[model samples]
Target: MIETDAAGKIMFARRALFAVLFLVTMVGSLCLAALALSPGGFGIFDVVVLGLFAITLPWMVAGFCNALIGFVIMRFSADPVAAVLPAVELVRDDDPVTASTAILLCVRNELPERTIRNLAPMLEGLCASGYAERFHLYLLSDTGDAELAIGEEAFFSELIATWGDRIAISYRRRTVNSGFKAGNIRDFCERWGNRHEFAITLDADSFMPADAIIRLVQIMQVDPKLGILQGLIVGLPSTSLFARIFQFGMRLGMRSYTIGSAWWQGDCGPYWGHNAILRLKPFTEHCQLPLLARDGEIERHILSHDQIEAALMRAAGYHVRVLPREDLGWEDNPPTLLEFMRRDLRWCQGNMQYWRLVTLPNLTLVSRYQLVLAILMFIGSPAWVGLLGLATAALALCDDPADVMRSDIGSVLLLWILVMWFSPKIAGALDVLLAREERRAFGGAGRFIVNFAIETGYSIILCPILWISHTIFLFGRLFHRDINWMVQIRDDHAVPFELALRDLWPQTLVGCLSLGLVMYSQPWALPYILLLAGGPACAAPFATVTAWALLGGLAARTGIGRLPEETAAPEHLLDLALPAIKSASRPPLTSSV
Candidate 1:
């Protein structure tokens, strides 16, 4: 019997909050040490700090340097060289019409009505696009529930009845949910992929604008060298505080990741599973995923199949690419912080398993290094925080408070924290100001400033929570603990205050101890250290309490900050609808010989 009382809910929230705080403390400590502390201890800190200052100071001082260089180069350089390969226009008078299938992978226990509502646009996309006759849609249900299956069948039937012969839709149920998502797609490919030249994969919550789909097909048809083309995946910020923050930060911080990946990777950019298209033959041929060794920590159905598949493609000498930013698609954000953390934990476990792949034979240096770098970035947060905590304890216990105060290490650490806290936001703010469409979402320059402030403030609060959670997750993985793959809950918005309290109490305890230590010893380094220790210790509750305040403010001010102006469905898409027939073409799909 589950308890319905506030007490139970509060306990859950407190646990969640504490998880985040723990991660932050552990990460902060490690990052400070890694950046400042050298092998010889305090003696090295000065040299390392001065070196970094020299390296970074120039970039800060020479803001106009790159722009001026670019300006001069562009003036003298030949028109940016066009692609040497001529575009293979699929619509050419003599080309064969290529038939492809769309595989929409629906995971465990997904909501029925929402799935249908969200997918309706894609169905319409098939009919409206010129390739209606050449594409078939398959909804692969990994869920075994009898009721949801029945609901999906009915919904699919309704779609057929409305559009008739113009669109074709079908459903498939797997006997086993093995390999998680990777298995789902593999199973479909073995059974249905041979019938199509390409397959567009979609996660349950992923959606692409109609034109984006058309563009995907065009690129695949033009470039036979391309095995996969993945587009930018943006977040849909549902009306929740946590959702808003996630969407805002991702929109800003992820550009560097996206741009850097595409630039450095060229044709080998990693696929993110959804919002992407794949040429069927190459994927089914080269991406025959091998089973992991018995000693491997990752489960058969692990979290990062996408990364693995991309690596396999490169190993097989095929090309994968991140489509330019012009292609637009969106993914729904997990509605609350708890959901986000749960999803991330599953990913951490899987990625930690993949850390071994860095040493796999026959891999390109770039691919190997990228895999290793990802592992470091993911695990480094916790390691950093743990080191910071240990350092604080050492200063308090071993060094005299006066001696620690006189050391320059503490000030360098403080400066590093400040730079990390604000630099990304400043970079993103500049990007937003530069983009016209993003600027409209902020409702002009004044509102953009307000939006940036709210988002940046929330990020500072969330950083410690996520840092703490990651630390706990990394520790658990290192000890070989069992971690479950959980569904990222998308609709729950409000977290009960009692739950928040339960999750936050552990951080509160840590904070109390740190504050007490600083007050009693008055260590010079303690003041700088306590903030990192006390932040998640204090910020979690402050966030949970203040969650409703922003929405309340927005409620009074009519439309101060909102999503971009809704783009109306273009005229051409209106007439197209799902087919009006209850029949599956049941095409014979066999594996490539």
Candidate 2:
């Protein structure tokens, strides 16, 4: 690993270069666009447009630069050094496990049967690894529903009876879930953390190979200063077309992006809550979350706790880092667009809550920047919307619509924005294309290209819908509206028309308003306006459960949007753990209450 001071210096230099490039590009582009839009003079409308541009340019620039750096790093670096832990060979079958570790499976009102189905294989694998005595597994439930709790108990009882003697297995359900998942974990730390050196937290949907789990423990044992080691998690075993498309892109993009991020973050990397191993002593002592005061409400719980925990760990002088290993961990994605939006809404609120803690005492500058970026991720959508509105108003009020359309600089700016927006996906595709092994794993060049094109098209159609959903969600969160902590919908089911309409009317209204305004102001720009509005206008229908099923089936028959795991899984444990892919048509047995 690079020395801490040397790494910090390099990261600072890279960040400075990125900032300079971003400012130059954004200023140059905006100035050209402004000249094209109004060569006569600057006006109030132009000033508003420029202000919106200033607010939104950083997000665009950051994304492009990140992708560029990631592409270069992944293309050139064969084996990047891990930032947090020293490299070690995998433990042999006869190697005696010295440290005690706990696997904490945290669940809420999720399907107990499904959870058991996923867990049974991992437990079997652990026993097979010949280190069963060294590791214990805990079923940490926060279910409040009486019937669901009983079902969870029944499942836990059966699982314990099946494998209790093979490994230490325990179950606990909270009567009152005070702070959600974070609180559940804190409770576990208070009760059992002292007994173990490390705890590997897992979500209900998380799956990791037993060997990978062992490797994490080994790495942590080697590095006493390591507080958290996060593994790269990719979406897997998706059945729906929407999920397949979304996850395929995620799998492609995350590998390189994570490596680049880890390089820059160095010792102060992010913790994504799960699919990570944490040193119990430091975590328990340093990462206890305190409530934030907001609008007369004292003791307001943090919605997103993982980043804060990582920050706290760093504040206590422990290194937190992410391992960018794509082959290790797996997770599930929302099966439908509406469900995805629902999940995103919760994340939007959680990330926005970081604004409350960005200036918390004892945070490193990098940690504070991480918090600020988290807030900007959601906030950028609204800023983009404002920019669009200002640009549209300027166009509508312009004395010469013909001149605005004739301007080559305006067209160039539009093209540049599109390129920057999709650069990450392009970079990911290039990474795959350049690597023979990666391309082969994606089912050869032809199939890979087909999948890439389909995913890109799907993402474009879905982007506007997300933009509107996130903007509204951000506004609601700012107003201190409470989000009901509910179980995530994980199965494929058709959304009710009424539900879709109720959820998506704001998007539809925005689409209609945008189209109407554009048609009134510049009929020549109708195509751009329609493109902007189409996704939102059709979001309700597109979000129908029936629509997702049909699209998924069509993609399946066409042999497009196939994930590498679906084509050929690298981990034997995955096949053993999940013997059969669950059918999308199977209804979820539990409610997300």
Candidate 3:
């Protein structure tokens, strides 16, 4: 176990300060509002509402404070922290270094052609940088389908024929997908991990610059104790309106938030599964995940393994760091709202599983806190729905309806909710506007403002729909329902109208019932009621793939959510990679070579 050093002490002190401040702000604001709402006296309903508020209020405040700290750091700091490799100069054609690193591309039953296309650029970039000899590339496949396996082999053969002479490229397909991606990596470690000092884990859609990859290796070489180092991954290039808007907001907010979190977290940071480097020996020794059993029944193995791995490494006396770099890495986003939720469904289940592991023996306090925060991330949605239900119940039981509506407490609570919910977006917008260079990258002040306005409006409408859907997913897990391990829908395709309605009708129903109830007793809450009802009413159309595509296209044409990558493509990397993949010689479908 790692001892808390001077830096660690400072980090802990700052974290303690933030924690106390957050608790005080959250509890004071909520308690004051509770007292004001029930001026006459405390009733059973008031007590219940307050208790529910106490449970949910910290989640909201924690997010707000994180964003608030991020905004202050980005706005005030002379030189804000960013994720950049140390002193990476342009490599000479003859420059070569010797370091053994394995680049593992773990794939399930995904489109093999697309995966090759994505991999081609990084391969070409490495060759061009003269680092081709330093790294070995492995296409580790856990494909279960017989036909897909054949296709994958055909592509792999072609790739090997072209690049085998220059780079140590190989392919292996496992008949059984045993432990999923984590298991796939563990298998590799057992077989060949000892040969390499470090391994860079990548997802199917992950793309990193050659320089960035080399930089990661160099950093690991310097810090022998670093177990995992995660780079910031921005959304990949997208023309679709939904993706552009979603990515644009993410780009704006992710940097500042990450930097601020890193400052407080210090050594004990997050490890996103992909676009990160792991030290092989330490990972092999400390990161084997345990299977959890409950009440004589063995539950499915852990779905989200990255964070647990990081925690395990830290518990074994290693540091896990997240490098906040904008240009280093890229990954794809779900192109439509329905696809987004489908992905969220899996993630919600995985994050919720952490509840079982938080109390695991010998884990650090910060590590445990991280697990709790992750659990709260999904659980907060249901808790939010619970809070609204309690408030509605209190309203129903109130003897004087006029007092409930007219009290200054109602206004304060509404204002508090709105401010806390949207403050991160506000801070992100400020970060964009404050820096002239960043502002110009997003197409100047006017375009930036327009994009923020549109994104905020869209998010407000989508909030309740997501809330209801997440609540359903969480409750489903409570009943021990099985989640299918399905390939993500990466391409933009139209969702059928009937299918959209079938999936989202429950959300629509909840919206209608909640709005109807509020309107009957408290017509003054029409504004909030409308916000709750809007998402469900719009769910069918938004859920339709074609509808969002059209909206995304319109938004793109109007310059609402413009990102720099869209305007300025990474020509050096993509130009070399895309052409090579398209023109590469391919073997016949039936060829066994």
- The estimated TM-scores of all candidates read 0.76, 0.91, 0.90
Look at candidate 3 and tell me the lDDT of residue 444. Answer: 67
lDDT of 3 at 67: 78
- Residue-by-residue lDDT tens digits, candidate 1, 1-593: 35436633653454344334434543554455444454344554344444443333322222222222222222343421111112323334434346575645555657756666556676677666666777777778777667766776776677667765777677777756778778888988898888888888888787666667666777677777778878778765344556655666666555443543343345557788888888888899988666665456544545578877787777777778776452367777776666776787777777776766777767765567457655654665554465445555655575454333334665676665455545444555676676666565445555566667777667655665666777776777667775665545666356666776676665556656665676566556456655556556664565464455456233223322233321122232222221100011122122111
**Model 2, 83: alpha-carbon shift in Å?**
7.9
Candidate 3: stretches off by over 4 Å = 1-5, 82-98, 294-299, 391-402, 545-547, 572-593
Model 3: per-residue Cα lDDT over 1-593, one tens digit each: 25547656777787897788788878787777675667657777667666666666666677677777878877886655542222123333234455699999999888877787777778888898777988999899998989988998998999999989989998999998767788899999999999998999999878787777877787677677789998889987564666767887787668656776776776788998999999999999999988765446434578889989999999999989877777778887887778888888888888888988999888999899889888877777776677666656655566676455446767787778777777777788888787777776666677778778878777777777888888888788778775777878787667778888899998877777777777787767667666656676678776774335665555555555666654444664445343212221222112111
N/CA/C clash count, model 2: 2
Q: RMSD (Cα, Å) of candidate 2?
A: 5.2
Against the true structure, candidate 3 reaches a TM-score of: 0.90
Clashing pairs in 3: 83-324, 241-552
Q: Report the number of backbone clashes for model 3.
A: 2
Which lDDT tens digits does candidate 2 get at residues 1-593? Answer: 56967856877886677567667877886776676557656677567766766666666666677677777777776555443223434334345667999999999999987777667767878899888999999999999989889989998999999999899999999987877789999999999999999999999988887877887888787778889999989886665767878888887777656766666667788899999999999999999998766457445677789999999999999999887777668888888887788788888888887887888899998899789888777777887777656657766787876544446776787788777777777788898888787776666688788778877767766888888888787777667687767888877677777888998998878877777888887878777766567677777777784346676665544445666664465555345433123232123222211
Relative to the true structure, how large is the alpha-carbon lDDT of every model? 0.58, 0.77, 0.75
Ranking by lDDT: 2, 3, 1
| lDDT of model 2, residue 84 | 22
